[model samples]
Target: MHTLSNAPLRTVVWSTGGVGSIAIDAIARRPDLELAGVWVHSPEKVGRDAGELAGGEPLGVTATDDADALIALQPDCVVYAASGPDRDGGAVPDYLRLLAAGINVVSTSSTSLVYPPAYYSPDWRDQLQEAATSGLASFYASGIFPGFGSDQLALLLTTQSKKIDVITVTEIALNDHYPVADVMMDGMGFGRPLDFEPMLKTPGFIEMAWKAPIHLIADGLGVEVTEVRGTLDRRVTHRDIEVAFGTIPAGTCGAVRTRAAGVVNGREAVVVEHIIRMARDVGPDWPTSEFDATYRVDVSGDPDIHCAMNLGAAEGHGAGRAAMAATAMRVVNAVPYVVAAPAGLLSSLDMPNTLPRYAFE
Candidate 1:
């Protein structure tokens, strides 16, 4: 671990679209981390000021698509919120370049990058491990639901019990779109047979994207995943509405479900399920249909424990903007730690305890 110092860390963000905007806002508000520049994927945004694009106060830095420009800035750390899970292949090469140039990276790419062999490219893993040998400075990738909620929460729950038998984590997103149907035949397993654009509204895709989350938790908790299975469902409604692309039938729902069992010494000990519903054919009300994302964590041991959290964009903090800020903050916080660890692929679980990485102040 690197020694703590009085000087604030120098950093830059590597994104310019969708969720990237949220991270940029968080960087502007944080005092301990400095936003050195911005990188946008859209060619049209290349010359615009970062603030105008992100809707924040102008810091004089303009958005650019050029990686060399970001490298020339001599940043101490790099916050990687650019490419999402599906686009990981496009982003890994850049990350490798950053590591070779001695810059640290943190990403929210494919879930399997947080684990090994279960879903990731073993060759890529080997490459990153080799890069780690270059120095302690490393790379990290996280899964939103599985990485933070399922895996981290499971770890936190274990602190409460000496004897543990089963751990389960479930996440349900009511209105958000997941593309399960489009990818199921690709071996993601049980999802809809919908095409790409429509698949985003499908259910099982979320579980496919998050498979590693449960796997990571089981591994971190000293257990083995013996079996992985899943299911997906859609809702039917009586109302219809016009969408930007077209019209969705009034009674329709796209859902996905997964049941994975991990066994230790021939006993099922861990189970994880991810459910997402974009349009419910039946609902409590129009408002509940428009709003409401529920999450729960249940751990069975000597004393059963559970955590049920209700989140509504009603307060303006959610998977939308708040998630952006949280994601940005996560990347910013990871910068310092990544800079000091050996490179390649790394996750929060792989972190050393003494690393002084974040300051709420």
Candidate 2:
């Protein structure tokens, strides 16, 4: 068993993008962690200081596009927050490289890794396991939705239940202010024609993308999900809508509703639903969040319960900013636990309670 150390862990920020920048700032604020290096994908970001890139004061560490150079630094953990739309083509290789180099990794890149056992590809899991074992390093993946809201929060609430007939975890977000064009437009099929299918709606893709949490919740509750099923619903705008990334032309896709349901005994015992809108009015009939971003969990059982987790930033900041920071901080805060974990892919259940260490301010 690995023991926690008093000395601050040398941490590296893998990207300076939305989530990665937040990780950089949050890492610097933690006393148990020290900002050591940063790896950037954009050439423009190269040679820039991580702190400044993250909207904070300079921290003396410069960002670079060199992944090998950052790995050579031998930091305790790498906050891998690079985009994961291409999970296998991109994120998996980077993860393998880091794990094989004896560098522990905590990532928001791959939501599928939140529960490694349920990852769609058994071959990939085998490879990751081999790499981690070879280097004696640990790896973990998480974020606000799949990480905390969907799995952790839902499972935590089941503790008070006398019987759990069904547990539904829902994520409702207004992404009008999110600035990632590729993710917002191409990946999610937003601003596309009604007949045009997005990657998310492709057969079995939703299950692959979201089944990790369903399996995790089932395992935690000591139950089994017989089969995983998915559903997708999309809506188009009647008028052009302006957003942080770009404008969504009238009659283009503007909102989406997707769900991954875990069936047990012919019933949807566990379900994860994502309802996202470019404009608030697009999905008026669908579920809405009290805040711009909200995660709601409803448990139907002996004692029915409902809980809402609202995330919001200050006046100048948008809801996406708060959700991004929350996502980044989830993995950033797990660094200590990841560093002290056994050499392998770890889920939340494998680690002890991770508190916001030194976050008393």
Candidate 3:
């Protein structure tokens, strides 16, 4: 959508998932932005007010599914919650069109993992990149995990230490209740027996997702990774556990354990451990049916330091629709910076902290 050079950000949201809804709620309470409208894929929600989907009374904005109608809104920015096929690997293209149409954008689509699409799918990278620069529009993709927990942001934040030591990040959560189909396959290591330990080198099924994130961290931290290793635990059919998927043994977890290490000039200094789920993985021996996460950072520097940090998000991954909705609104709150950011594939670490402090309620 087009915007006058001086007007406040006119933000349009493309979906009302969990995170998107939360984000919309944030925007509904903010006075700096105009909640352009809401868009959805299903017709059932087409006429409902965005406030209802979010957590408010009525903003008068109705949900619609037409992409063209959304672009016609001429919003200053767009928050995308749609992923993969819903937009047919075309959401990035839509963002480019929005920029070319003079609207900045932010999204949580996994595909936007890194802007310029070239990083994952080159189908529309240059087109979007060109528009981002020429149109002076912003386009960003971020998530609590890959977007923030991965390299370029959280990992890079450790560069201020005088000396170097070890870095370990673990994302542990109870994930036996998720029901999405697409995620069931890619995100959850389904298909194998409910009690199988996923092979680390199966070629395509390992939790190797940490490689790029760790590599990015290592490279930025001045370390050279000689090799990366990943391990996966698939729940196997057993006699002790019983669910819709049936019984599962203890030797396996529908989880992936990956570690990426880098040797720095003969001195091994970089290591990353990505513990996706612990119900049957790393923490299986500790607890079950509980939501928990911990991030550990240990660096022996000038004064030598060791810190262990944990964030619990077990109820549900905020990104799973509900989380994205909240984060989307937060993204809307960061419009100015996301727009003013340098024209390129920008990382959250590179993007200055601009959003207002989130109150812990």
Candidate 4:
């Protein structure tokens, strides 16, 4: 067992995009973590200070496009937050290489790795396991929805249930402000023709993307999921709406509703649902929250339970920046526990409770 020590853990920020930029900021600010090095994929980012890339003051640590050079720094942990929807295939090999080099990793790139064995092939699972064992490192994958919003928070809420019957976790977001063009336009079908099929509607894609959270909840409840199923639907915009990313023309795909359910016996006992909209009016009939970004949990049992969490900006941060910070902090906060954990692919169930490093003044 690894013991807590006075020396800060040497850490590397694997990418300087979206969540990766947030990780760099958090690591540089935290007193318990040392910003060792940064690995960047873009040559333009090469030689830039990690702090500048993260939109903060210079931290003296230069970002490198060379993966091998960052690995040579011998970082204790790597926060892998590379863009996943389009770059997942390459991200896996990067993770494997990092783990093999004795560097623990916490990532938001591959949601499947939240509970890897549930979605990954046995060969892939064994390879990751073997690599971790050989290098004495650990790898944990998580994000906002799959990490805390659905699996972890739902499980934590269920502890209050006298006799739990069903648990449903939902994420309702007005995604117009989110600035990922590929994910918004191509990946999710937003701003696309109504007849055009997005990747989310592809058969088995929803199940593959969400099975980890379903399995995680089921395992926590000590129930065997008989099967996993999913449904997808979309709504068109009635009028043109301008968003931070781009414009959504009238009659284009503007909102999406998807549900992935895990069946235990004959009932959909565990469920993860998403109601994502580019504009508020696009899906008036669908589920929504008062806040722009909200996570909700509804548990049906002897005494019914309902919980809603709103995520937004701090005093100086914008809503978009706060959301990204929350996502990055989820994995960043887990670093201490992950480093202290035994070498392996750890799920939420395996790790100890992770709290913020500097919550109180």
Residue pairs with backbone overlap in model 4: none
Candidate 4 residues lying further than 4 Å off, grouped into runs, are: 1-4, 313-318
Per-residue CA lDDT of model 3 for 185-295, tens digit only, reads: 334544344443333435643324455455556656756667555544433323343322443344444454555555555654555555544234334543232334445
lDDT of 2: 0.88
lDDT of 3 at 45: 83
Report the C-alpha lDDT of model 2 over 203-321, residue by residue, as the tens digit: 99888888999999999998899999999999989999989888999999999999999999899899999999998789789997657788999999979989999899533356578
Q: Please, what is the whole-model Cα lDDT of each candidate in the order they appear?
A: 0.59, 0.88, 0.57, 0.85
Where does the lowest 10-residue lDDT sum fall in candidate 1?
184-193
TM-score of 2: 0.96
Candidate 3 steric clashes:
29
Clashes of each: 20, 0, 29, 0
lDDT of 1 at 87: 63
Which is the leading candidate under TM-score?
Answer: 2
Provide TM-scores for the models: 0.79, 0.96, 0.75, 0.95
User: In candidate 4, what residue range of length 10 has the lowest lDDT sum?
Assistant: 313-322
| Candidate 3 Cα outliers beyond 4 Å, as residue runs | 1-7, 84-90, 111-118, 122-124, 152-160, 176-179, 190-208, 222-229, 235-253, 260-272, 278-291, 298-306, 312-330, 357-361
Question: Best candidate per lDDT, number?
Answer: 2
* Between candidates 2 and 3, the lDDT winner: 2
Q: What would the per-residue lDDT of candidate 1 be over residues 1-361, giving only the tens digit for each residue?
A: 2344666566777876545666676666667667788888878888888777887777787888888989887676776765533566877677667776666767764456666445546677676666555644567765446556667666777778777788777765553322233233233322223332343334554444556766787777777766554444334445553322233454343344445556555776766666544444343332232234545678888778887655557432453444334445555556666666654567667775322244544
